[model samples]
Target: MAALMTQFHVSPSGDDSAPGTEEHPFATLPRAQRAARESVGAVLVHLRAGTHVLTEPWELTAEDSGRDGARVIYQAYGYGTDAAEQVVISGGTEITGWREHEGRWVAEVGALDTRQLSVDGQRAERAGIDGLPDGTTRTETGYRTTSLAPQQWQAPASVEFVYRGIYPWTEARCGVAAVTHTGEHTEITMAQPAFDQAKALYNYEFEYQRLTGPALPTRVENDPSFLTTPGTFALTRSHPDHHVLHYLPRSGEHPSHTRVVAPALETLLRVTAARDISFRGLIFADATWLRPNRSQGFLHYHGSGYYEGGDIYTEVLIEGRQWLTVPTETATIPACLTLEHTAGITFEGCRFTRLGGTALGATAGVGLTVRGCDFDTLAASAITLTGDRDAVLEDNLIQHIGLDYAGSPGISLLGTAGCTVAHNQVTDVPHCGIVAGPGTGTVLSNNHTDRTMGVLADGGGLYIAGPQGDSFDNGALVRGNVIDNTRTPYNFGLYTDYGAAWVQVQDNVVGQADNSAVLHVGPPLDHVVFRGNYWNSDPVGSDAVPAGVTYENNTTLTDTDELEAASSAIRARAGLLRTQEPAIG
Candidate 1:
């Protein structure tokens, strides 16, 4: 006979003082977690349908783990009957008591400081202006603009300078310290160290472009002077008592009618040293991070890698080409949900949306499985796995990610072994779709990518680079995947770059990309094989195989009938097996 499991309940309207039964469930997750910690064997914590707003992160540790191979499951108790019924664990506070001031609605948010705001479940644009005015030049402090008056703005110190062109793949952001008017030239001084540090990082540019410094800024944000347009919001914190929020109504929006949410917490969940935990059919939403708003702002070096204080660079040889690589000790845009030193964790059929950072991050964990999830409208990457063993990411719908940070990939796995990323639909991404960095026995298969590498350079649909074990001896395998479209200018469909070796690409399809050059190769590449693949257009990388790369049995379809028949099977087997449930692989 199977062992019986203990169950507890929690709800948005529940009371913590109750008996914690179904009829009298706990009002908060922490209360229910406290109750679960007192139990043994298998346990289930059922979160009823409603929004559970949190004051801090809902955390679980080893003390809350299950025993004897039993699992502690946190799931949605009842959701199938009503499509609108949901279990939302949010890190935002609602804004209310709106009144009209001049032409727009105004609210006195007591002391909330946030970088992201959402109105009616959709992300609202923080007030911004495009670039410095015409006669602007970079100064020792920040900039000198003759057209825009910085001294007269309501919040002088809160304006953010967001810049691109640090490289083709880097976007740097910093906060303004002070603004002053110097006769005809307005001086905007930025926060120290990070501002000067970004200039040094930009000096180490990509090999193609040996540029000087990053441009002044593509845009500037969070100034009340730039809030003239509709559908925009601005915050003025220069007041003595409270920070004021001014929101201009869109064509059909009213602050009193629509819901406005400003995210307050950076992390929604933090699990450490836990085992045998699962989250099912839940929603993790509306979390934001504000570390980038600090003086030491975000300085991105490459994908999933940012330089905080080091200007370190090392030269490496790839396929006879010499290139510079930097240290990626830590990543920028920390995940709203972080799991460290945990094992036997699974998140199934969950939704991660409207988040300001990465959805999920797991490191130093074994047997982590993320399946059948929907990730949308994120500012950073969808999923990131680092130093985890035997992790599986399958059958997830990842779309519209990297909305703010364009260099983040859809899925990134680094420094791992015995991992599988398969049957996931990664679409509408701004950078690479799937990236494998410095791992062994990693299989990236049956996945589908569409319209990837749309904004950044030096990326591809499936960018498999770095050390991938011994040459084809249970090494990394890239097979049965489909690359639908990569319409960007300087990217590829299948990329073997950065001295990646001992990898195999078999039985895949590349369609509707830059058909003239579907494949991309970077030097120091060794012992890589590409065979039994179908392309809609002829790829030009075959002309010169160089020395270590080999191409065999790769077909280019000129005939319509043969192309249609061959591509049908490869496309059918790609992406999710089913929407309701992920098929076991």
Candidate 2:
């Protein structure tokens, strides 16, 4: 006979004060956790099918860990017995009391400062403008509007303008500082300059030299003047105690028929200093994040535009923070799930969707495994593992990530050793697909990255940047991946930037990249190897592939014989022919 294990049950219809048995379940996860901590042996917390609205994060510490060849398993009921049921742990509050105003729907959501909104499980666009109004002109200080009344520009501090820079593809958002009516034109002063005018590489003459000759296209948002489109939302506070949300519904959507949800919390779960914990078959969704403040100083690149330097630019702020006069360090926007200082933690068959920050973040952990999960519609990276050892991220589907921020990637691994990122599919991101850096012993193989770098330029589908200080990403193997359709400027199918060294890239299929060369190498490379790769395009030559690099048996798209051979080799090595589909509820 099997040894009896301790068990606790949690259900939506139960009460927390009851005994956590199969018949009488606990209502909240915290109560179940407390009971699990008091037990001596292994424990299984079974969650019933329903929605679990969490106002705050469910935290687990070292005391909650399983010990002595035992484990703690938090899983959905009917996981293996029957078909998977819907178990949604949501961080957002459902909004009610919707009415009509000026041919639009209006509601009051108390002081929730979120930029994302969803109606009937679909993301709605924030009210914005596509281009500048006619007769708008630029000045040395800011922009001037020709036909604007004083009432339209009232409360300038709460307004923001998005400017399409001289390059026409690049964009920047600036807060409004002052707005004045000068009878002839309305002058608007920005809190910061719209874009970096001083540091221009290709369009230096048009961007910096001729400042007032032609006005860049601009659009004002976060105000009430431009709330004309359907499926758009705007938040405004006319009084201190009253916050109004204005929304234009789609053609068939109505206030009484649709389900509206606004995000309330940032973090849904936090596992701290714990060991031997597993979370399975759970869905975490609908958390919000606010963008951090920008810095006054700027760091300009030679070819790219100027970048603001502050807490937003660095990765060290992921741990702790200090807010001084200059705000040297700041807190990270919390993820839907955060794991720190933990070991042997596994997240299996889970789904993370509609989150404002990262989906899953593991910092300073050991033996963390995230397998067979789905990460979708996140504002930041899908998975960010830092300072971890022997971490594994496999068989996951990461899509529609970095929707709000362009700098973060789909999967970011930093300062990690003996990590395996394999067999995942990453697509529809604004930045890189898989970015590893400043680490060692990393194996990135058998992944598929497509349609990446849709917004941001100067990145790659598979990218590595590093060798900072004494930390070297030596002996990292990147092989057997399929990357396609990188259309942004300065982007590539495979890129090694900064001081990346001693990496082996082999036996991959790269196709349909916008740049002529599929492989791109930046300066200060050391001991890199490229062998037996099949490119479905022409090589751009020395500009992308530099000297002193080992290149052998690499063929272009037209060589059908070599291409078929290479494809067969890659498929045999990975042991899988196609990507896995995401698990459904």
Candidate 3:
């Protein structure tokens, strides 16, 4: 006979040698998982109210999957009760032992390789350039500056230069190779030039011109001289095996009283090829991620260069000249929660906060759902779902994401089919809000996005693209979304670019966009239908609304009262679920 359903318990004060019962719980999730692996049928692991520090990933592989209509659930102990408590699963190490040094606080963290630090549950700033450089002149190779002394630029080779070009939308980070002085100018050569200068198109607009050229105005960071501001920190290695943190504490904040932490692990949970697993009511926090520096290149395909009506197509070129643009690099950055080749996995009512990389990621999964979760203060993208089938991301609140990396979106869906992205509020992101591409049967509805593309350019609140030949016969539906406050120079509220076809966009309210309210660009803009959309601002310079587009029932609001009413109604219907409530029955 098969074993009966099993229940395992984990707590911070429990012992691993216990029987994993309500009274005697295991100490860690991995120990409970080990006990669950030895059992059969259904298994549920209850995590009590406490902090669980993860020194390594809590991996759930295929062998640990539930069988025969059973599921493996990891949830809070009192999940549905009023007494439900907070369960924190952290991937960082708390630091103690502070001393004063020259009006600053210093701590010895001992070989922790991280760039992110948190104090009292707030993300502290990394030391960066205080202001703009003194002077920047374009060079044949890279750029020359008269900003700092030669010794001030002699940071380690790992230091990078973040440059904001002539356009607000154009930015790049390149590694420094050597910093030397030529006459009166300090010449800095990059390991790899941000972009090829020879391939730049000179006669294009300023926005397009920066995309094809070399670096513009630049600011170098991570130098020791910039570590003067309060709540800013720098990590220095004085010995081969020891690392120290130099911190400028804020007023009334001291190391002895503050809960200071630095990220130690890259991933908190790794579900690999598992099935019938669910994680709910848990907090995942404080994981580090380093962006890999590889041979990255961009390709700018000028439509005027090819044909008469071809628009400028700028994409991250990977290998060939086939006009294929890859999504933001995912294989290099680590995430807090990674689900790879997993099926029947769900994350409900969970919290992912203060993470250094992407918060949640799923690759090649089926029957995946991320519902009623909160993703905040993330360094990279909030959520990325790729090559998944029948995926649903709904009723989630994502804010303050993409704080460090500007290339990623708040939510990105690539090669995902039959997916529903609805009722989610995504705000205060640096790049796009909801980016769905190269997919079919995707329904994006009732999602509110605000203040997106705030720091970067050339994106939108709702951005969609596809391959050249796919017909989108499944008919992607983008309806009832509220896109507001897209303030970047070239960012649109709703953008369909590069062969997006056979999609219906309806009933969305777009307000206060820098670019057009709805923009259609690139080639093969076939069978895109826009209906019943309310534009709160004038769409003045949009010319890519092709002749065959099915544009009908769209309205432009001139009255303030009507625009405010429409915007308020849309927000009320598409608002975020900040607290736990009953799921839609």
Each model's lDDT comes to: 0.82, 0.71, 0.74
**Which lDDT tens digits does candidate 3 get at residues 1-585?**
875779999999999999999999999988999998898789999999988999998889998898888998999988878888799999999888888888777787787777688999899987877334657766666668776663474344445556553234444455555677777778766554333322232122332332334445355555555777888877664454587777788889976688889988888899999999988899999898644222132221210011111133445332233222222222323467899999899899999998887898888899999999999998878888888889999999999987666666889888888889999998998878998887878899999899998777777899887641245468688888988888777777888776787788888888777654544455656787788888876554334466646777787786657876856766566656553354587
What are the TM-scores, per candidate, against the unseen true structure? 0.93, 0.84, 0.86
lDDT of 2 at 550: 62
Identify the leading candidate in terms of TM-score: 1
lDDT at residue 352 of model 1 (Cα atoms)? 96
Which regions of candidate 3 are displaced past 4 Å? 1-4, 130-132, 136-150, 153-158, 165-170, 177-213, 237-240, 292-333, 467-473, 538-545, 566-571, 577-585
Ranking by lDDT: 1, 3, 2
Candidate 2 residue runs with Cα over 4 Å from true position:
1-3, 134-142, 149-156, 163-172, 191-219, 292-334, 468-474, 516-521, 542-547, 558-585
Q: After superposition, how far is residue 492 of candidate 3 from its true place, in Å?
A: 1.2
Candidate 2 lDDT over residue span 120-206, tens digit each:
878776686655557766675666878674247435655656543433233445555678888788887655532333122213232
Model 2 residue 499 distance off true place after TM-score fit, in angstroms: 2.2
Q: Select the stronger candidate by lDDT from 1 and 2.
A: 1
Task: Say what the RMSD of model 2 is.
Answer: 6.6
